[model samples]
Target: MYKYNNFYKKNFIFKIIENDIRNKKYNIICTRFPPEPNGYLHIGHIKSICLNFSIAKFYKGIFFLRIDDTNPSTENIKYIKSIKKDLIWLGFKWDKNIKYSSNYFDLIYKYAIELIKKNLAYVDELNIKDIKNYRGTLLIPGKNSPYRNRSIEENLELFKKMRLGRFPEGKVSLRAKIDMQSKVIVMRDPVLYRIKFQEHHQTGKKWCIYPTYDFSHCIADAIEGITHSLCTLEFQDNRILYDWILNNISIKHHPKQYEFSKLKIEYGITSKRNINILIKNKIVSGWDDPRLLTISGLRRKGYTASSLKDFCYRIGITKQNNIIEISSLESCIRLELNKIAPRAMAVLRPLKIIIDNFPSNKKIKLLIPNHPNNKNMGYKNIYFTKEIYIDILDFSEIEKKNYKRLILGGKVRLRYSFIIKAKKIIKNKNGNITCIHCIYYKDTLGIKIDKKKRIIKGIIHWISCSYSKPALFYLYNNLFIKKNINNIDNILSFLNKKSLLIYNGFIEKNLLQLNNNNQHFQFEREGYFFFDKKYSNKNKIIFNRIISLKKKNN
Candidate 1:
């Protein structure tokens, strides 16, 4: 297991940001999570959400959830709704209605015009390829566009015409007038605006021209008076353009852009395009597929919101890019679930065990603690009977060394019940063990046993056949076959074939309490589970295995 320090302690990044704020004498601290409404939010996004919102909460300041819906081609209302749902589900509350970059279109357009009149930006007629060729490589300085010296009057008129849809798509673009010979290629006159004759999810057809993220992001942050524009480390180089725009534009606020490393897991990929391919190929169910790392997916898989928050905290904030072992995330979930998930009994691959000595047709209700360490969780009654079901994996005809479970002619303790000894085993024609005969000790029910007298080392969980409820158990494994597959083209090929497995099982009646309360239950020796909200029905109880009792594959 991986060890973690106190995540609540303010780290170097927070300390630096705090010192900078104090030096500026800023009273209100404002932070924002600006995600483009192009796809569902994934696990990586949660880190930013937690960091930004936690910082705001720590200072009792303002935190805004902003949708950067500049490109209408990919943005949609569904994505916006999903993003909001995810943030809320993660236990975060925004100050007001969510903000949209589209809302500042008019102001952003006016600012663009302001830059045009000042000769800081101009409209260019270069096609995509010509523009790329002109933007020289790292070692080479770029040549200025022939139209880069367009007069202010002509540039303003052409920009107005372009917005009016008079210019065909790709025929015109607005480029910043930053030095073409600058060392940073991103500053070599990046495109500020482009024409896209598409319907916007929010603004409809009111706009034919949309500003690029590089041009609109800082402006939106400024308009909202954001004090700290926190972004992932990938945008560390973009910080210059982020500042350049704000420096040249006339804005009321100048937010400092801070970049931190994004969250990434070794066995998982969070890119939206790759995830969408998985959905489109029907390799998985949907975005909420339990095997996926998306917030909705994790929720459907029976992970608790608190556990996810704990994971984010454990990962902490850093400027260096790193791929964390997926086990760390599983460990966090296991640790949290172990403390909170109530214990219950279940038999995934059941083998019939008949306690021939016990009274038939008699129901013995035994009270078992819901949680071993937490007495406040109270107790539930598990009905014990003559015929009960134990996991088939817990038994063996030929015992191996150090095997602690049931074997022919061996004695074992049934959890929450009696110490029983296997007397005889009935086999079918195929040599498959169909049933086992056992004798239960009458006085062994929930009592302290003398180990010398009984020599019982094997203890197993079982559910009474008479009182157990039939359930469908869905087991989830890691989705990807490889630990680290960064290339998008090869990611799908590494999809794990055994990612999901379903089994018909039996859960003790005591589990109904947890099911009814929407609580997670640890199925003794099996794993943590909860009701499958989408597939369960009156006729069939479907439970999703959140994670296993054993450590996951490293």
Candidate 2:
């Protein structure tokens, strides 16, 4: 095993593992990320994936990608494939071939038989509702089932019948013969196996009985020689049963279970059930709709793996659970994109500007740096023509206080070009401003003019009307308006109806020369955007806004 390093020493779980290593507990440490193939992996799973995979890599140990496909009624092959693809996209390599709980069904069933022979487990005929009543509440001790005291031979026979498709779904279940009156509710003779008539995606219809997650999880861990079984705080109580099953079983290399707080973000829905509801109602486009917090959705929205990993590391590991601000996660992507995304200018809501002083036939090629701070990124050629488009928000007929953008008879500097003074405005019959006529100072190009004398204190990005290409823009925002959705009964009521806003815009024509590599670009004074390859074609180009530019600090 590799020695514990300073980087991982801060994590409490790593500290525990380091102590085990120092005490010569085992030769090699092992970990696994076992996800149920019921839904797509979300932002919440990213933390666990990073923690489990990072710990194993840091220790030079083994890590496995196991599919916890115990309940086949909800599981599907698509979800399993999505899980593997997400892991690979996030840059994690699992050891050997992928493992499945279904692969060890025969062994787990044999272990169940061993427990029955040892008189530690018994088959229960109690219905689901009656079993719940017998389980009792946290304040009350549970009562034993009527069939709890069945003879070992009878219990074994009934269990074998259950395995042989003799029992219908929910007609019979195998429960561990643990304390029925225990204060911990899960230890009140928890069900180990239940009859599932549904065909499993992995095992098909070979067997009619299925093992519960609690029973299969620990045994699978021990069988694979997993040293640390890490899960979220919700599974902390399940640890009792995890230990009980492992301790009574005739298995070696029992792994210890540890729990940490799950990652939760404000206004973000990570629950697969709720997301499915949204999909069913057509509230979102699909699983990768970019509005959802699913890993695929984030990827479609241009969130980089490095940024996500940085977010996970910054959140760190802890026992206390809390809802993190969405801005915290947004900061990670913003910071990263600022460094790498090339600069471009786009006018979402365009207002035409005609420069009267500039030559109508002459077009100046202005070389602008792709990155403001990085000189090594070089520059791109942007055309400066007599007619151009500026964002409608950048101009006003009646300027408000502190508004520095263009105004009638007022001057503002065109970014990287010339200082232009708005002389007149053209309006339609409806009184909506359609265009602005301006005059440009030819000598102001690349020069720091006297701001006090000219009263020109604003700079706005513009694209040449003759040289730019028409494009579509998709602006995305939070799906929910409410910050704390825990108490809300109907999540749809709080849905942000205007979460996705579409706009018709123009981009630099030079961008068409670049390869279709799904590149991310920072629209000057706009935001970070990803070229939508799926929607874009030779006739129409589209860009999806990942996030808006952050407000600068004064």
Candidate 3:
């Protein structure tokens, strides 16, 4: 229960709440996590999700999941579906059906017209290329558009024509009339609506004119009665435009925007632009590739829903931008799986063990406990035989004074099995040792009964080599090899080449019960692992290592 001190609890939630209340803070402040549904969610999004949702829960206010799917050209229904799946996987859910920027399109258009009536916005006839040029340098104010002085009726008529598809694409755009000399580029007459003749995934061709994310976001918050519009720090520059829109329309309840440092995760790229490039270039398998940091990929790679939520809470909230070491995620998962997952034996690089004393046809069965720390989950049985397998790395053909593994005349302990001493070695013409022959010590079963029995320093896991089951084991880790992605010129250079090293491995028999929907387990002396969404079927079992064996006594 000590974990409750650092974990989510009602006491801690309101404890922070009372402090904010006693400080004359805004009352009943709601928060919203507005994700643009253009790609699968990532670990970076998890940070924002936790911050916004936890604050809402902590304050006893409603939290909203609003999809900012205004840009239909780059957005899709597929992305929205993925976002909803990822969110539910993370264990956070909105109370009602989710809100969408496209859902409030008509309201946003009317509000834009309100701004037009007030002469705070106008239709710009400049080309996108020419508009950037006319915006001038940062040091100088942008020159006013030749069409800036158009009458409100003329601008509204043109806008109506734009809505009715009377204008060609790139002919004109509805832009805010804010001063062009403002330090933030967003304040320099930002575009509100564009003439995209493409069909929208949601509205299906009902409307041709679409509002930009910048123009639709803040107003959507107000419409949903969201008190705090929590978002990333990059949007800080756009806050002025958000406020300008609110003031122009005089919304009864203007939402306040708060910016926190965006998560710049090490070992991964969170930028949609970069992810899109990866997809375009065919450098990855897909958005759901196990190497990817996207939620789809993580789920495919065998990460559990609770592990992700626990990871977010462990990182907590901070105002400053920091590249989290990424090992923090590894730690959280290892801790989680170790507690819930069953214990199974697997040998990735098998070194054949031939028991000399036991008959070749003899077998042994182990009733091993599933989870050692937890009791309700009882035991499992693994069939063992004379011909068993241990990791090759756990042995040496040449005798080692310090090594207690299967060296000539040395004793070693098989994990929860028996004690054995090496007697001979079997090799092939290629000068490779294929099998190591050892004698089982009947006097010393798992632990030595006699104090004088040679103390074995080497302990290892072994599966019946004669009754081996073919399984694909995946070794997964951070995708990026470098710490600072910005420091590297090409993202491919940072790609961890060793991210996934797949190999054939042996598994205990009961493992059949542990291969669905990310059933997790820790292989003795190997690492924590789980079943990947891919490569998992009743006929074939595939697992990906969630983390290397914990770095404690091991």
Candidate 4:
């Protein structure tokens, strides 16, 4: 497991890229992140990003960003562009020489020709359905195709015609001539190339025939001179096919594939298939919706690149399948933010509290540290006044034991300001309490008993109504209501009804003067939040709670 300490971050990074001037230990360790351009990258993809790029960085070699856009029907140029952007955003820079699976079509076709020449592969005219029947099933031996016995010359001519678009899609396929009952089913004459008439985004109409990933990936790695082809565990079985393809064709470099377990975060689905289903059904707002697990989604939700890297590092890597608690990830972000995020004051679901004894328009600014324990972040002032807005949940009309907040004639600290005691309850015509009017005891009561004396049972945050700014607060909880967001239960039904709540809230005046470029802040006694980068400004800012403070690792 890669440790979370700076040392581990440094070593795991370097291990992938060890320098050797003597050339005795190892050669330039070239690695590639070959993502199929069908969907956006998710948290799981980040683990791959870290492993591949960090290895390249560690070995002083190259990390190539190769778009494995072989499937023309589903792959898109938009996804390719977005994946490149995602890598850059994740703080990874690939080697200058970029590659795409489509770029090697010429070489792949040449290799297919070589396979045909060696009598190691042949063109099979069997339609996919009949081919599957001939390929047999789990407990039976497959029968050889009728076209399997075609003369090498006839097969070559037809293969060239297949490349020249003489055949319809799937009417003919180029398959490897491996064992029919080798036990390992994939080795049983697997299809290496298929014909797709669809316009490929890249290498458009150059050839109708394209090599499958199993065939193309190994050849590409060898062509690029990759040393260690690290991939997820799902490819372990595919290693046989990859080896067969590479071994049959002599290449400059023979890369070894090593598989590790994929990352899984519970309460989140990282599957592009599932994401596509959700999107097609209009279940999510968009790819960048904060509720999603896509890179853009996480970024939109205010996840910092460094924090995400730390989370990936903390989770470690192994070959065993794991369904990590989403809370573990949240913990990493919170731990990092706690060390760097600035502190502020915000009250959501504001309950108006008017101190009648104090001057109606008075504003007293109290010095508050930007980071409670770190003065180097500097200090800002929070205004306290006669009229203030506290959280509605922080107060109860009827008191319970240890319910330290506002109630009938109860007293509590006003956080950095004079303590006030409720003197009267103001109500509406329907007997619902409209507001609670109180009197500030500036001398003998509150968080500060005097200039030197203090009484603090529970400190609650409030924003001055007289001087503070009103912000639109978006409070978000876990998107799913299910206990296991990964497996079981209907995720669609578990989608929290109250995931995103819009409220007109109050913030300290200093928040109004806040620099919009910085998206991080912790509202004292409230939660962690960031001013929305896309929709916040000085006059009226929109703040989104990244996560609340009540959330702790259990």
Candidate 5:
């Protein structure tokens, strides 16, 4: 048995497990994360993954990665592979080899036969619609099917026929003969197995009968001796049926089920159906679209595994269902990247600045710290040339109240270099300022100038036009504009049209050496960004902005 520990007493689930261990409930604690291989795992799954894995690891128990592939209609090998990859990327090592529910099909079938022999199960010939009509709602009790009273021997024969492909799909189903008048609607003789004339991904066409998730899940847990079965609160109603199946079946280990609230973020959609609609309509590129919250999407967007785990820890485990502000998650990544991400300067919507007073042929190298606070990270060399590029947003022809940036005839400090005064402006035929003429103070490099005389209170990041490389930046925002996305009938209608904005930018030429290294960068005044391996190549560089410097007020 695992020893009691108060390390995670803040979490209610841990407290329950601690009590169970204190009372000597079992020989060892075991937990499993069983994901149905229908779609790529999302941010919501990260919560359960961290909880289960942390529980087992804390108690020195066993953790299992199980695939609940009972339904083959939507399951795919690619999804299974992606699930495993996501787990591995999250730094979790499942005990023993990965388990699949399909591997226990024969044994689960035998258990079903045992229930039939014990008069606890019966095969029904009712169609899908009639079964639903008989299984009434929460306010009304369901009535038993006419076939509910079939003898055990007849049930065995019909169930055998179901296995032999004797009936077409949905013609017959095997349901447990439980209380029909029970308040828990799922306990009203829930279907245990159904006939599907579909090919299985793992078992192939060896069997036509497939067990329902409610039927196979508990049996699989009992078979593997899972000590605590953790699931989301949506399955709270199914707990009664879960225990019913385990208690009636002849299993040595009957694991208890525990429910916790699933993670729901505001302005985000976790439903696979809704995400598919977004993809089908081409609102997003694919499942790995950076705007999405899918694990792959987040990964592609440059969210680190450690940052996600930290986010899970910050949210913690709870029974109360609530929508978490998306900023809570973004804050975790922002805090993490602030310490590790290298600082670089990039100019999106570049405004040309010609330092007329500086020597035209002079190119001075300046040492810029990779991280402001992290001295061990060392420094990087950036060139200061006669002409430089600054973000257009950083310069204004006329100054506004409390604006801390460059203006015509105003002075500002060029980051890590010298102070510059905007002397003149060059405009185009449309009266739009295309460039600015400036002069740099030769003695002000890394020097504190007198604010009383210079009035240079603002510092702006800039990259040398002669030494900068052209790049593309993908700025991502919330996929949906509505805070209450759950009530959205048409996701496309409420879609944030400007969720993804592309910009042609210029970064320090030295950044080219870090390309394809999967490096994360904080672009000085710009937000955090990751080198996009999928879109970047030898000819062109691309980066996806992970998040802005701070959350914008909606």
Candidate 6:
């Protein structure tokens, strides 16, 4: 609730809206999140999704999910489906069925023709390489194309031929006839349309010519009655081109474009190109690899939707770029999970322990609280048995100063059970610990021991060897070792080798009830975990470690 204050306090977009309303720029507020359906949505897209949708919701305006599928060469239905799925998972709703740039291809072509009829646009015969050469550098003004003076009749005929696939790809392109010497490079007669002989995914072979993004986006916004077009700051300069195209057209409604800073995170790359490289190179399992920062990956990694939304809200929106520390995101997940995730016992690395004094055939049940701070969650029963397993790291063969765990000849408490004292240590060939022999004090159950005589300060979690279920655990770390990926030439070398660590361990039998419950659980002192839906089956259970209890230093 307090996070919304940040958006209203210093937000330039909201201020712009307020000024526009005062100046009677528009009667109603409307916004759109137009994504290119070429790749899956990344974590950076989450902020844009929240900003655009929340702005519309706060103002009671219409929000649209428009697919900017201008380049049919790379667009596909899979990416489109993934985008919609990710948006729904984030809990945002659109006003109607998804909109696509392809849906307005016919109208867009007419608009391009309109620009040409007014001599504001022309079909150039210069090849792709020659056009770039003439575009000039930052220090020089771009020279006009030799075909710039083509007759309006000739240009219209050439454009028609391009649509009919009579011209080869890369032979010619439609360009806006703007001042080539303008300070902004984007205003230097940007390309309006290109000839792509390849078949389109949406329109198929209906047409070979496609309108460029610069030509399609703004008009599509106007056709949808969008009032405020919110996008990343990189498009700030393109605002001129956006307005130029819209104002030049005969459209009655002209939507204003507003730009905000893009989301960047430390140790992760959000660029779709780089992510695609990682996928192609097989550095990651897929787009949904938990080590990745993509939304699907985060979902697979057991992050709750509320936590992601909270993270976006807390970070707020700003005009300057900032690299958010990954730990800040993790903290949000941990905070949310601490309140909702149920408690369970899991042994990531098991060490056999035998309660020698207890009867081998006897068993007792202890009721453990599901959550320490929330009583309404109630409790679950765990069995106490002669044979149990503790984490190997919790025991030491030789006693050391201030050691709090099961050092030989030392006493410790079994969580929710009784005090136990180590009597002997069993070792196998090559001097490796195979089992620990201990004796439990029968009266110590649910009672505090005398401080002077007990000398027991350690408490650890364990599972009954007989009742625990075998499980596979996946521990994940950041995908990249470096905090920045500025040098992309050798970026693959920076992939974190320890990004994923696997272990075969045991979990409490009671956890089987969570098979398809979509629940997160804390393994007592170990860490938070969830059933891995993508890799789990009836015969075997695989879990992904959500986050460890370790706190990151500020």
In candidate 3, the residue pairs with backbone N, CA or C atoms under 3 Å apart (3 or more residues apart, or in different chains) clash, namely none
After superposing candidate 1, which stretches have Cα over 4 Å from the reference? 1-9, 450-454, 513-515, 550-554
Tens digits of lDDT, candidate 6, 260-314: 8988888888877888898899988888988888889999999987888888887
Look at candidate 5 and give me any clashing residue pairs. Answer: none
**Model 4 poorest ten-residue lDDT run:** 445-454
Off by over 4 Å in 5: 1-7, 452-454, 514-518, 551-554
lDDT of 2 by residue, 24-48 (tens): 9978999999999999999989889
lDDT of 3 at 343: 78
Going through the candidates in the order shown, the clash numbers are 0, 0, 0, 7, 0, 0
Model 4 Cα lDDT, one tens digit per residue, 1-554? 23334334544334433433344445567888999999988988888877777666655778898888788998888888889888888788888766898888888889999999989899998998998898887899898988887878988999989988999888999999988887777888999999998889978777677888899999988888877788888889889988888888866678878788888876778878777767887877778777788998888777888878878877766778888888887887788778888888788788889888888666666787788789888887667777888888887777787565776667777777766777788888998777888887777432335423324335677888876778898776767776456654345766777877889988776564564456788888777887776766557678777777764321
Clashing pairs in 2: none
Candidate 1, residues 499-548, lDDT tens digits: the string is 88988989876577554775588988788887786777789988888988
Q: Write the per-residue lDDT of candidate 3 for residues 390-506, one digit (tens) a residue.
A: 888888767666555666677778878888888888889998889998888766655544535556656778998765687889887677788767445578766777877888878
TM-score winner, 4 or 5: 5
- Put down candidate 5 lDDT per residue, 395-424, tens digits, no spaces: 888978878789888989998999999999
Error of 1 at 528 (Å): 1.6
lDDT of 3: 0.79
